[model samples]
Target: MATTKEYRLGEFTFPRGWFMIATADDINSYKPRQIRFFAHDFVLYRGRESGKPVLLDAYCCHMGNPLGAKNTTSYVVRDNGGTNIEGDCIRCPYHAWRFGPDGKCNQIPYSKDPIPESARIKAWRVVESMGAIWIWYDPEGGAPEWDAPALAEWDDPAWVTPKWDNVGMLAQHPQEVVDNISDYAHLGPIHGSTVDRYENEFRGHLAIQRQCGGHRTLVAADGTRSILHTITTYHGPGVLISDLTGLYDAKLLIMHTPVEDGSIQIWHSLVVKSPSGAAKAGITDAVTAAQFQETSLLSFAQDFEAWTVKAPCINGMFVPSDGPFMKQRTWYKQFYNPRAKERDYLDRCEGVYVPKGVVPYSEATVA
Candidate 1:
């Protein structure tokens, strides 16, 4: 796998952001589920008491046992009670050592000794929203500065149920995936879309791309085209949401979470407005929603195929029509470096390519 230095992103391999670890329905309180992200192992489980999700390092502090593993003899499943988990805390399978949601060891079954302060694993800050579990990660071990995004469409009664596709993982750096936002030249050839207007806007950690175009598709016996107005926004580095208006009022969610130094796990989901305008419209057709989801997956597959097979572009050769690749990349580097290093990158690359009417979100005015 490629490293951060391989892509010339910065010193840090992973960027700071709220990345999706798993869907909410994927985990349960029955047993701890083991997950690997950022090249590290983590255990996720729902708290039996609070009924909330908990995330912590996968290994046990006492004997280096995996907390998620099912062991009949280990105290995790047998000690004090039939199950190892008491409320939200998870017991180590080997020694029955209970660790709280805060990552500190609270109880020891065999010994009457005080738990050592060092008997703790790292507890990650996690939030459940939009049917997914997002974990906040900072290379420097700092807290999240911004909140995860929430869509108003999620709560709207007119929208149909959402559908998700596990696009799976690709062995490439996330910088390569994020680069697609500023890539305007590829719309015509790659996705069969004629771009009327393309622009990129930066607002602190958020990156927004607006594209107005007509997408060509086979609507009938003869090939026909439909005009689509799309506005895509990146909440941080990992999550992207696109609101598209044309034949349908639809929303597409694309999330890329780094599973290793150079690989990312991709997820795609789509939701569309229901034909019937009722809150509990039993009239919404599941078949129509599934068909729309299939079309969305086909459109996304074009980008996914190219990203998986192509060579990594560390320093891309830029052109006038290629969009603001340099500016976007500089903004992306801020997430990988310390807060202090952000200014230097901004100073060097800001104002290089400001869109006609869009204001650049930087401290200094563009020349």
Candidate 2:
């Protein structure tokens, strides 16, 4: 039975939002990378011509076979739509239908006239910045356009940052990943006490703060003391940056790219404040080398194990000490609630969950 539900990662029925897809390396290497953003089931291909980056669609709508997964074909097709640096078109493997980078079916082997304009598949709105590619997933098309989060240091030459990048599966909703950032209880156990007793509270505003680089941290208070998280998000929907105060002398930035529904491709940028002379001598080179060697492997393995094993959708579970989770629940409700402004009056209803400051259920009900 195919349910209208999109994800099978966990108990979660994922609502529409932008998700992280891939890291910079995944698409920038010699071989092009193909990624799928699950919320809308959109696929992207990072094609290049003369060393220039081009991101386009991968699947053919006519037959559903992947467009350019092999080397036998030109790997790019020309649609009647338009051609870019990578060429005007490519040939499909299954039926040999031609497609342009714009995802139009240029020609059918037997048909004389070109494919219709309505037959073309869609391409994502990709923004490349801070060494990563971000895609927008706007289901209702109501998603507002915003600038990428400001990261001043990316262009600075003086700073040397270590990086760990990888793609992995998370048996959870996108919201679960974001909620983990503010969930303090798990930090002590899962992250090995990296975060201490953090107090989270609702500030009831789009709380934004400047970080070390051009990254700005945003927090919206829900209800829990531990759920108040500092999230570094860009103007678009998909990119997420987290400044880890515990890793690499306490200055590391994590960028999460949505590849699809069940997983994410990550870029871990470990920015150090400064290093000693001996460490600084070859430290940048050393750290970059280690990133490809040890750090990336270790971090990916650990996170993969942690998130996959836990209840993927963690909101329903009641843990008295999980203040952060509680807070995030409130945030989630507020974020999706259409009547958020009038939610206070609605709290008077029976059995409807409300945050602490809202009228308590005990007071509203007769004992």
Candidate 3:
């Protein structure tokens, strides 16, 4: 797999940002989920006591026993009716040494010997929102510089909350996906968009793309099409949220988190405003929202298909007609480099851009 060094991303193999670890529904007290990302293994579970998410290194320090992996034959597990999870803590199946949610060993089960302070696992901080859990991953071990991905619409009663579509992992590096931010030309060729106007902007942590056009896949089945406008922003390097106004007023969330150096996990979901415009979304609104999400998923699948098989774009023959790919690439470097150098990278890329012959989004209309 091509690594971050190969792409010259930065000194760190993984960029620092808030990455989706799992959905709220994924973790349970019955079985901890073993998750792999950033080239490390982690155990994620819902603390049975607080009902909050807890993340720890998969290894139990007392011994080499894998904490979250299933062990059906062990008495340590079977005695607990199939799990070693003890309230907010998890007991090592091998030695029965229980570790608290803070990743400290609180009990030795059989020994009166003092539990060394080092007899613990590595715990991670996680925040839950938008029906998902996110970890603020930083190689520098700094607190989150910004808020996790969220939208007020997720809390609005009139918007139907849709389930996340796990689009699976992409073998390609994230640079391939992040490039889509300023990709003005592909919008026409790949998605069959007849763009009337387009523009991209870079400001601080946000990479914004605004466009209005007629979309092919998002239209009605009987060959009816309407003007679609999307104001999309990369909240950071990982989360892409597009507020769309077209057939339905909706917000499209396309989230990707690095799993390995050259691979990333992508998820697609959409929150559609009540089709009936009712103040509170009804059962019928939910059904309509599901259908709309299916259509939106189809749109994202178009991009997913190409990224699945493409080689890395280490060097490209960029032109003025193309979107500001180079600028966006520089913007992405901020997350990979030290936070102190963030300004240096941003100074070079932060600005509004329009392709050579395109009308700016602020000036475009369907007519």
Q: Please name the candidate that would achieve the greatest lDDT relative to the true structure.
A: 3
lDDT of each: 0.79, 0.43, 0.89
Q: For model 2, where is the 10-residue window of minimal lDDT?
A: 211-220
Residue pairs clashing in model 3 are: none
TM-score of each: 0.90, 0.61, 0.96
Clash count, one per candidate: 1, 25, 0
lDDT by residue for model 1 over 1-367, one digit each (tens)?
4668887778788999999989888878777888999999999999898888999999998889988766667645765466667789988877678899999999887888888899999999998887888999999888787897567776566676675688999999998889998888787888887666667876677788877656764122233325577788888899999987655667889999999899999999877776444554244444565677778889889999899898888768886657888788888888889877977876655443444543333322311
Give the Cα-based TM-score of candidate 2 against the true structure: 0.61
Which lDDT tens digits does candidate 2 get at residues 230-266?
A: 3333222234444433222223455454444555545
Off by over 4 Å in 2: 1-18, 28-32, 39-43, 47-57, 71-85, 88-90, 93-98, 105-115, 142-144, 194-197, 201-239, 244-251, 255-267, 274-304, 312-321, 333-367
Q: List the residue pairs that clash in candidate 1.
A: 76-84
Which of candidates 1 and 3 is the stronger one according to TM-score?
A: 3
Query: For residues 1-367, what per-residue lDDT tens digits would candidate 3 score against the true structure?
Result: 3678888877778888888878788889889988998989998998888888989999999767888998898899988989988899998889888999999999998988998989988999888899999998999999888898888899899999889999999998899999999999999888888899999999998999999888886655464448788999998889899989877889999989999889999988999999899999999999988999998998888898988877788888899989999999999999999999999999999999999999999885564
For model 3 the TM-score comes to: 0.96
Instruction: After the best TM-score superposition of candidate 3, give how far the Cα of residue 357 lies from its true spot, in angstroms.
Output: 0.9
